[model samples]
Target: MMRRGLLAEFPTGDALIAAVRALHQEGYSRFDAFTPYPLPAVQRLLGWRRSRINYIAAFFGLSFALGAYLLQWWTAARDYPVIVGSRPAYAAPAFVPITFEMCVLGTSLSVLAALFVIIGLPRLWHPVFAIPGFERATIDRFFLGVDESDPYLDRDRTTRALLDLGALRVSLLGEEAPPP
Candidate 1:
């Protein structure tokens, strides 16, 4: 079933941020904002932080490098010693290039996988597109949305909250507004 929600249009990014912050202070958390341009203040107000993909990539990269180095050492030094040019079997220097390559492979692949999982990719559509005038969200308008799944969400209440916070227009998204 399509989810219903409340949407508020704002004239400016600052206004959207302010409304989001006010709603957040009122114990509303399940909301999102759309702006024509990057708005760090809106992100901050929405409690967005640094992405965890960086940490995941770093962990995978370091682990893969260490594992590759160990495998090389074990193979060269213990499993089957190969004395080339009278050099030591466990040549740490020789493993550097392969280890670096393994690190890069691990980091790139893990980051790609994490992004797909975290961002919920592969979807062609979202219900937010049903909001009136939402198409302008990418052009000139700033929008604040309160999802229906939010525990505190109430149609009338949300409408009033957005209106009180200076929304230019408040609309019910994903569902038709009830007749007055």
Candidate 2:
């Protein structure tokens, strides 16, 4: 199988953060870090931008609300005109409640769907999980994983750089076990 990536183990969160910073400076953008706790520094170094979920939510919410209002208006005015209490057939005020409810429903559902799709939810497995000792990432150890597809990735050089950055060990990650 093709190489997946390289996983480097760091003894401390600081070391992991430093390694990420150095790699970023060295023009490595396709890497990820794992730590027992959140590291704002690492996140910044990774250059993650704000999520687009809000835009998605707004788009879907407005679209649904408009559709609901149009449907209500069409039903009242054209589809099945109902003359009730001498009110106009396409009464905008009467559609307010359903339109607002549809807006809320669409916003919430879109946010949930966007979050799931962005994060690849319901994932049962990841290649990182196959790396021995990686479980420590949830407890104490911090890790930096460099993707093989990175333009700057040269296995030997990356391993050396990671080791120089105070990595305890660097392992090849793929479908098969790393070489001894």
Candidate 3:
């Protein structure tokens, strides 16, 4: 099967960023860029939003902490009344340490889960990986890949635009069969 996308190699990050900006301005939204290192400019031009991992962590953390506190209170006061050191059975202050610990645990675990889900973890292969010299994405090259599904994509016109934007090479990626 053929992969329906165009992958272009740029001489530098600047060229890739320019191409992304140009594509975005041209109403092309279904595209991604790869580079040896993170480029905030490229991200900004791509209009990528901040991740919601922090919100997920916070929600889970606070929820777990509250649950921990309530569990402790119910066990000590209502479930089975217990009095130690002449303190009240439902000592809110005493539950602070465990509550905090549960909060941290929840935050970490939720963040891990969110990261996995957000990144589509366990994905060991991608069509781009089949492209020759694409491994340079991690070493010293910048790349822009425009999905054929993009509404503004005209294979011929986009190819010409990429070349005009100083792309060193442009390739039409072929799809690779998924691992069984």
**After best superposition, candidate 3 residue 45: deviation in angstroms?**
3.3
TM-score of each: 0.66, 0.63, 0.74
Identify the superior model by TM-score, candidate 1 or candidate 2. 1
CA error at residue 31 for candidate 3, angstroms? 1.8
- Runs of candidate 3 with Cα error greater than 4 angstroms are 1-3, 25-29, 36-38, 81-88, 151-157
* Candidate 2 lDDT, 18-135, residue by residue in tens: 8998888889988888889989898778777767789999999999999999999898988999888999887889999999999999999999988988988977666776788999
Q: Provide the lDDT at 126 for model 1.
A: 69
lDDT of each residue in 1-180, candidate 1, tens digit only: 224678889998878888888888888888877778989887777678877789999999999999999999888888999998899998889999999999999999999999988878866666776676788989999988888888888889889989988899998777653434
lDDT of 3: 0.87
Q: Relative to the unseen true structure, what is the C-alpha lDDT of residue 173 in candidate 2, on a scale of 0 to 100?
A: 83
The positional error of residue 168 in candidate 1, measured at the CA in angstroms, is 4.9
Task: For each candidate in the order shown, give its overall lDDT on alpha carbons.
Answer: 0.84, 0.88, 0.87
- Candidates 1 and 2 compared: the better one by lDDT is 2
For residue 65, give model 3's deviation from the true position in Å: 0.6
Query: Which of the predicted structures, 1 or 3, would earn the higher TM-score when compared with the native?
Result: 3
Judged by lDDT, which candidate is best?
2
